[model samples]
Target: MMAGQEKGDLSLVALTKSFATFTAVHPLDLTIPQGSFFALLGPSGCGKTTTLRMIAGLEEPSGGRIHIGDTDITETRAYQRNVNTVFQSYALFPHMSVMDNVMFGLRRRGDKNAKAKAGEILELVQLGQVADKKPTQLSGGMQQRVALARALVNRPDVLLLDEPLGALDLKLRRQMQMELKRIQQEVGLTFIHVTHDQEEAMTMADSIAVMNAGRIEQLGDPATLYEQPRSTFVANFLGQSNLVRAQVNPGGTDRIVTVRVHDTDLEVSREHLPYGVDDVWLGVRPEKLRLGEAGGPNQLRGIVRDVSFSGVATQYAVEMPWGQELIVVQQNDGSARAVLGETVSVSWAAHHGFALDASQDAAAGAELVEDHG
Candidate 1:
């Protein structure tokens, strides 16, 4: 256990970091509630890691304050702050046993019952049976648990996970995602995770901040950010979105706004899109689209350009007349399917469609995704 059992919300006020001429993290204001799983998600060079490092005291902010509840710790050294980071490398001592590795910090501080304290945390991480094992003797997943055990033993006010699962395989990364969430809930400690993987953040975080060019593009619960993206970058970055240039039509009833995409007219919820703008980007997620008849509230005709199967889902690339390829994903549940080189009609409900400012680049985050891969 840690020396101080203090607990409070972590707050960042106008947090900014710059490297001479380059500003890595623009003025950022964020608050992570106590005991919440929050993720800072973005592609490479987006400043998520810089913000995390500043909070961990590994990097000094050029401006602003960091607080745990009401206590300011902006000038605190890395070791002095009640914060711990679980890095991708694990960083376990190879010569020591698992118990010693976990208890090293406590023993160095002269905690008399360090062994028992470490044992309890090891068991909490389901590593009690392997306490005597060396770091070299453990599997990758087991080694990760030992690293987690070492962090949890200290019971820091906030746990920073800097792409801790980046070194694990896809299957094991997913397994650890759940395990990390389970551990956070069981221990009731605030967790700040920084990663470029959208799916990883969605699966593990209670809320996410999508960063782009050192600024937050969007911040909300995973479902809200995915279903009701407010910007072109967010609409494309969170997941695949089919965006088409559109002009807002004059006729709209109460809550619906009409927009004309090419020759087709579609309606979007006013809550999701603004009405005064003449030009907008109509957006819809791939999974929400259905291959159906031409007549519908929001429908478009396109030719199937490509098809791919990945066990649980089938993805189709539908090419529009204006040289844009829109993606559609369908579940493999015995439903009728579309084939390549076939003309098809795609339709979705009015609520499923969203609108983004036409001024923003439609392909804002596409290249970044490819670059990361």
Candidate 2:
């Protein structure tokens, strides 16, 4: 850690970055707890990478202050701030053995026990047996671990990971996610990770900030952001959501507001719709909808347009009367499944939904869903 910068949260105040007419990052403010795993998540060109670069002091902020704990390091150079970054490329020296590559940084600073310090970090990342091998002799995952070991050996106050797992295969990427979380907890260092993969972010980070169009759309724990998305962008990005157009009905004015979707009426929790609005989007997750027409508070009738089976679960694209398709996901647990062209009734509890302002585009983040999933 930088002198006296220990145990203080990383704070960014009024941070901004711009290029000609395009603003990469708007004026922003955020605080990250010390010894925590925080993720900046969004699709490409969403300013997540730019924000990470700014935090690393690689790209100077247009207007803002960066601080570590109580110490202000806004004007400090990257190396002087006690911060290290590990990139996706795993930039290791191919000519040098793993041990020597890790020890190079320590030895450069004239540390007396560079070899011992390097060995300990190598073991922490579970790459001790391969210490004598060159980078070319190792697998992609092992090379990534070598890069992590090299940075951790520096013992920096904060580590910035710029899509560190982007180069790995799908199976290896999942494995590295677990390994990264384990290493973070054991080292007890503040880790700031940037990635466009939603699953990767949710699997590793304790807290996540979802960015869009150079601004933070939402920030919270994984479950909170996935369960109760505040806007259409968050709803579609985190996971699949079945959002329908509805109007707040004046007939049943109770503690919970009732909204009319076509001819059916549904209730949204008062907490969801803090302010009264004439029109709203009733949002519910695909998994929450059941394929039963039985007695339920909320029910909608639709024709099954498409059916997809992915072993774990079956997904049905049900087209409603208004030509809107709502997806319903059902687990394969020996229950009767709906088929294509079959008329079915979908039901869900009223409290399972959330209401958003109708003014927002219903398909705001639709095009980017595939990249996230």
Candidate 3:
């Protein structure tokens, strides 16, 4: 299945799922570019896991269709589809050695070369030295490697992962994130990873689908998704954002729009906004916002109500004139963070704020359906 295959190519059309009175995922339509590291990111109960399961053929969709490259596998059973998954559980056999666990899938296919292939995959995941170790003997990270080897051993056209790093500790999770990326690049396989960690998704995925209630809120590169979310839900979900409800100022340049928030008018750049018309949410990430100097084109006066030192950076909750608490992040450059109860000016470049439309909001809410259901 190697030569002439479109690596990692997948297409989902109007995919949806419902369980009796509850809807797990809303109808979704997306085309994942071949061989791209795509992330489905959302909180718990978000349909990310369900979506991955649907792709893996573990759960049938309530509606819509699925296609893998040129093959239409909508009705195909899980085993018949050319896809494999590394679940969050690792799901390795505790009684079997690493090599045996990896070889399990191949053995079921009656491949006499299963041992050779399993050894090669174990080496690829840097677990060759522990090929004979049982699951209980290996560390969490090592066990994860075995799980990945098990998935990759089949050489599937696409690999799906569901929070594969969720079980590891913080440091180990970070380490594994890099290792997973390296392996994905090495294999040049299309990897669809489901994760709730925004930083993890941003670090690993070439593009991400930020889901809400079984629907896609935004799909774009990490920079695009973070810098220019298309709806209020997306603005608030991906990271810490100050959502200032505003309207586009009429008679401004296409790239510049004025919005009214809290009895004050704010002029923001529209270049980053995804909507055509501007009844929009001013989406600004905490880091994109700056404090201190005032009297800028896009600026706001606010009182710092609270502050917390988080080692690497300082977090401030600023009460803006609009009565909304805006979060501001200041890098810890060896200086003390801003103090609470201080009056400060918070501002960002117009380009940093984005406009969103209603459909985007609905899509964002849909990304969380599974978590809630």
What is the per-residue lDDT of model 3 for residues 37-136, given as tens digits with 9 covering 90 to 100? 9999988777999999999999999999988877777888887777899989999998899889999989987889999999999989888999888999
**Residue pairs with backbone overlap in model 2:** none
Model 1 spans > 4 angstroms off: 1-5, 294-296, 371-373
Q: How many residue pairs collide in each prediction? A: 0, 0, 16
lDDT of 1 by residue, 1-373 (tens): 3322467999999999999889999999999999999999999889999999999899999999999987888988887788888877999999999999999878766889999999999988899999998999999999999988898888789999988888888899989999999999999999999999888999999999999999999999999999998888888788889988999988787889888888887888888786468889989999988887532478888999999999999999999888899898988978789988999988888889888889999999866765442
Candidate 2's residue-wise lDDT over 1-373, tens digit each? 3443465788989899999889999988999999999999988999988988888789898899888889887898776667778877978998999999999778867889999999999999999999999999999899999999998898877889999999898999999999999999999999999998888889999999999999999999998888888889988888888889889887555557788898888887777774768898899999989998542578889999999999999999999999999999998988899889999999987778888899999887767868633
RMSD (Å) per prediction: 2.1, 1.9, 3.6
Model 2: lDDT to the true structure: 0.87
Tell me how far the alpha carbon of residue 357 in candidate 3 is from the true structure, in angstroms, after superposition.
Answer: 4.7
The TM-scores, one per candidate, come to: 0.95, 0.95, 0.89
Task: Say which candidate scores most in lDDT.
Answer: 1
Q: Residue 109 in model 3: shift from native, Å? A: 2.4
